[model samples]
Every structure is written in structure tokens, then in C-alpha cells.
Target: MNTIDKRKLSRPNFNDPIPNMKSPSPLPDATIQQKAKTDAVDVLNARTMAILWKE
Candidate 1:
């Protein structure tokens, strides 16, 4: 089996305990995230408008 299949087979308990590394990482910056969300919303809204215009 592949690594993913092996993991699925023994999901509850694996060969080793889960790690607890607690190094904090900063979240994505607000402007970058806002741009991505805006792009996605624009794409969806354009598709919706196209469908409505067709109907």
C-alpha cells in the first residue's frame, strides 16, 4: 500500500505518538488574504451573473 493508504488502514493508532511542537507561526497578512477572497468572490459573482443573464 502507498503511504496514504497505510495511514488510512491504521488511523486510530500509528507507529509513533503525535508530536507537540509549539513554535508559533504568524497568520497571513490581512491585505493579501482580502485580495484573494475578493478575487474568488468576483469569479463566483461573474459566473452567477452569466447564468442569470442566460436564464
Candidate 2:
């Protein structure tokens, strides 16, 4: 018969309370960001076209 050793068992320390730090919330919706990016691109294209037309 084989006997298990009690000295090899590991235990956690319960003397201190764990920190309650929480992660930040998720980012805003994807569609809103996409709209902003598209608007920026459109503005840049309009400016470029205006400059080319003036030259």
C-alpha cells in the first residue's frame, strides 16, 4: 500500500484581502467610429480637389 505525503500540500495565505481593481469598459460602438473616419476622409478629398481646381 502507498501513502500520500501531507507535507507536499500547498495552501494560499488568507491574511490579506485581494485588491478590487477592475478593467476599463469596452470601447464605443464600431459604426460610430467608422462614420467619423469616413467623414474625415471625405473632408480631406474635398480639400484636395479644391486645391487642384484652383491651380
Best by TM-score: 2
Residue 45, model 2, lDDT: 100
Worst 10-residue lDDT window for candidate 2 reads 1-10
Model 2 agreement with the true structure over 1-55: per-residue lDDT tens digits: 1233443344444665665433243655576678789999999999999999999
lDDT of 2 at 39: 100
lDDT of 1 by residue, 1-55 (tens): 5999998877775566656533243655576678789999999999999999999
Candidate 2 residues lying further than 4 Å off, grouped into runs, are 1-28
TM-score of candidate 2 on Cα atoms, chains taken together? 0.48
- C-alpha RMSD between model 1 and the true structure: 8.6
